[model samples]
Target: MATTTGTEAPELTGLPLLGSLFDLKNDSLGTFLRARRDHGDVVRISAGPPGIRTTVYGVFSAAGAQQVLAGESANFRKDNAFYQEVRESFGNGLLTSQDEDYLRQRRLVQPLFTRRRVDGYAAAVAAETTTLIEEWRDAGAGTVDVLQAMTRLSLRAVARILFGTDVDAAVEIVEDNFPDVGAYVLRRGYSPLNVPRDWPTPGNRRAATVHRALYEVCDRIIAERRSSGGAPGDGQDLLTLLVEAESAEDGSFDATELREQVLVFLLAGHETTATSLGFALHLLALHPEERKRAHEEVDRVLAGRTPGAGDLDALPYVTRVLKEAMRLFPAAPVIGRRAVEATVVGGVAIPAGADVIVAPWVTHRHPDYWEDAERFDPDRFTPEAEAARPRYAWFPFGGGPRACIGQHFSMLESVIALAMILQRHDLEAVDTVVPVAPAITLQAAGPARCRLTPRRP
Candidate 1:
């Protein structure tokens, strides 16, 4: 049993019956920010009406975030409604598994993401980036929707890395269908009430179609790979590695489990990295000085050559710029979990079985930890400055055992892509203001368009 303060956290006020339903649906990011601004670190926010009104305990402070995500993580289970929806859509992979299942999956998957192994994928990342750069140049120096471009770039890159020889068969299906799948996940994940997925509603039907297509492609690729009789760990790509992963006690993931893991990889691998790179470029476009600084670093580090794993440490300023962008627009803005038992967080008592969320969108900008919180300054990530803040203050990749497994892969991909792009062209924001909304991931609510000028010729 856990001790509590016996007092509940302050609640965000809402309308009659509907509570904060409309407010959340309209602008969830703003609502979370306001909750922390007006109601303090820990606030109770409710949505929907009486019976189905879903209220979550919003832990907004870095310390509170740490408590929920790290310190007392065992008490916060991923059995929340949002995760349930994710599991249904994505499958019971590492992202949605609980307890022993998650641990076993983690053990099997960990070897593939090791620093040395992940770094080996740099050549693949560089190759895809080169292709994107060529495409942009061929299109001429005009306004480009970076978010869209990066989304495609990341999907293709990950698909290539995952599918290898079968990249052609997998890339198009993932790129075309993921948006619908993500939209469906967001639609149901936050809803206080959802009809059964088999109900054949328009949303359900579309989601089912996309989900099936995505799964079939992955299954097909996996079958082909297995039929090829190539050893799992012996292959160059990630899917081969996943297929080869084995444990003494737990054995290996079966075919269905393989599809589930592939779905998760495709979702997290492309979407989050795309969000970071898109915003990093957009932010650079808006701030001339920062962009110039980044360009200088890129030029100095790569010296008119393609970026590789070795260049990551050499490009500190560019890395910081990406860090700042992630700080401002974390891909996974809000992470949810359910309190398994009564507990106290930041002096507020949360009852057992309560829905809980740790919002990086809010914690990254916590006034106490971040001065001039809304400003974009890469210097904030300098080692000395980062050490000055609490650990959880800027968790764009999340924290704890459940933290994103693709963290290193994402950073590596973002750094290489950003460096390569900056080396070729200078950017200007066509859509100066990139408003964001919380979907399955943090998405620019409108077009994140930018104009690029060739550095030479």
Candidate 2:
């Protein structure tokens, strides 16, 4: 490990407990950005009862993130406190599991998320988006929560693509479970052990019950699919693939593992993508010029037709809007890791067992790395401009071996959904400041109110 030649350990100047807890409860990115500005790129944060130290690095530069994510194994481990929280809900699924178990599950599940298989779901995505847009069109000039709509649309897409059935009955169950699971996983102040399921406390019982119900739903889906011989014939749904995948050493996922994988995809895949789409639409609504540009692109490529897998490459501006939105409010904003052994990050010595946090929300908007970092500029993600950025600078899906396996699927779904919606309707944001809150994924605090008007012919 490289040692810093400086005389004293760098200390962040603030009310450590209050600031840290406030950030934990509220907007973590804002807190981190303010702290980073005040206390340089690498400052020790003293938070929690145990006084854990966190190193917040700039998102514009990828060196520190690369070191922790893709560097040698001796330096880092996926053993963060948050991972324990995720395991509470997702069990040993790919998102939380580490080492060999993670590798095995990822390998088995990876083949299902291959480019070819994901592309196959494009038609289903467009169809679902069309259904959603039809409903929005019927309710013209009325206040609608685009965030909630996106959540429903994306959840339905995941359901249809993963299970090969509409399964609209499970939608309410999954939607109710989301906030509870999110609070339980992302918020650290809450304790799973102490809080009883029947407790009157705000999110404790709700989280517990929702988690059980979600697992039950997954269990039922798996059993139904397996007994039915994997969704008829020639189906490319994820459940079908899971029931059929084989491992060289351990064989295919057992019932429990299958259940966990389903839960992970249901929660991680849909919710994050929905949140990103919601934010993208919100950004476009706020910026009419960009909205007009996106509408023009949608009209040109899609030509009033619903977008399919083939239309994705042609909708570059729409892709840029989604990219910029994710840059500002990344679905999985802050990724955490624990140092398994002493290591050096950006010339600073990090002791073993230290907590490391890499925030794409912060990094993507770093002033040093981006021009007018705070402003919403989709052009920054254009082909020519994006080529100039560092490889790891703008990783909303993350990077390295443990990166999100469903990135391509999520991106494709977002583009198709956005294009379909744009084809039929124009969205305008209500003149209100919607706060972004983190609960496993970033979401609008209240409903993201917008008015949808049918597009003129």
Candidate 3:
């Protein structure tokens, strides 16, 4: 097996406990980027304990990433240490599962998120965004946090399309529980022995309660759908598909598996889209000229009406802005895999059992790959511009066999959301500071306060 001998391994010099502890508590992407810049793309660090080596692979090139994701994937497995913490909240959902279980779950859930099915939800996305915009207008922008607003709008859209019923109440349940679950999963030294739910620790208790509440919500939704007898005529929501989906072997997902899948879509699908939209809006507000270009594109194609799925192709500029926003702050910023066996990535030997971190945050901003990597230039994603670049250099939804199943869903949702919003009101950033926070998803550190004004004729 390929191995990095003591002499061949990247030099490691940081104080083990201090660096590891600080990295665990602070921005992981920032820490990893700094090390990569200082020590080159392939850097090894001792993460606080013996035998626990962290390998950050700088995938600045498409070929390098393909090597890890496609060429030598068999040697890599989902990082169980990281995912075990997530399993506490997400269970063995597709996002956290590994091996055969993961493959099975992904196969069963893939059909529901197929491009054809996801496209059908465009109307729902536009309607939801329109409703929220009208409400925001009626309220007369004192100071609205667009992040929270987008979260609500995106959640409602997911609810309408995924469940076929407006489950706004359940959306509220999810919003409340999501942060605590994310915090619990991200905490360092996380283990079953650390703290029990009954302990006095606020975080522990909150985690337990949130987990219970999430299950209850999922149970209610499942029971309601089952009683309703599949989809109502003409109802093409995701839950309808899930209720009817059959496996290749003539089996269907059991209640437990169904619950997990539903929860996964409910959480992963909506949250990431909302975060991307929030960031897009913020960027549009900051760059008035770019925002004007987007508005002009929307005005021409949409012609002052709501956008449908067909409008997606015509609104290329709007889509570019969203793509660039995700490139800058990918919702799933960093993805890692533990080497099940020794492997070679980009011609570099990766030892067995090493954690291989592939950070889109670093890759997206790599000076070697993108021109003006730090700037917000949506034009970079235009057809002509995109062709000039390598494929794997930009993977907000990841790639390979495990690429995000809901990518088309997100793109459709963002296109509709952006087009609908631009058609109505023009937004401006408030003086308030918008911090960048990396949670289960990268979100505006705090509320994203913005000023909204109705566009004049």
Taken over the whole model, the C-alpha lDDT of each candidate is 0.90, 0.77, 0.75
What TM-score does each of the candidates earn?
Answer: 0.97, 0.91, 0.92
Question: Model 2: clashing residue pairs?
Answer: 59-363
lDDT of 3 by residue, 248-323 (tens): 6536777787788878888788889998898898889888999999989988887787788888899889999999
Q: Which pairs clash in model 3? A: 435-445
- State the weakest 10-residue window (summed lDDT) of model 3: 188-197
So what's the TM-score on candidate 2? 0.91
Using lDDT, give the best candidate's number: 1
What ranges in model 3 sit over 4 Å off? 1-7, 49-61, 188-202, 231-233, 248-250, 431-433
lDDT of 1 by residue, 287-354 (tens): 99999899988887788989899999999999999999999999999999999999999889999999
Q: Candidate 2's residue-wise lDDT over 222-298, tens digit each?
A: 88888888775566688889999997776889999998888888888788999889988888988999999999989
RMSD in Å for all candidates: 1.6, 2.9, 2.7
Which candidate has the highest TM-score of all? Answer: 1
Worst 10 residues of 1 by lDDT: 227-236
lDDT of 3: 0.75
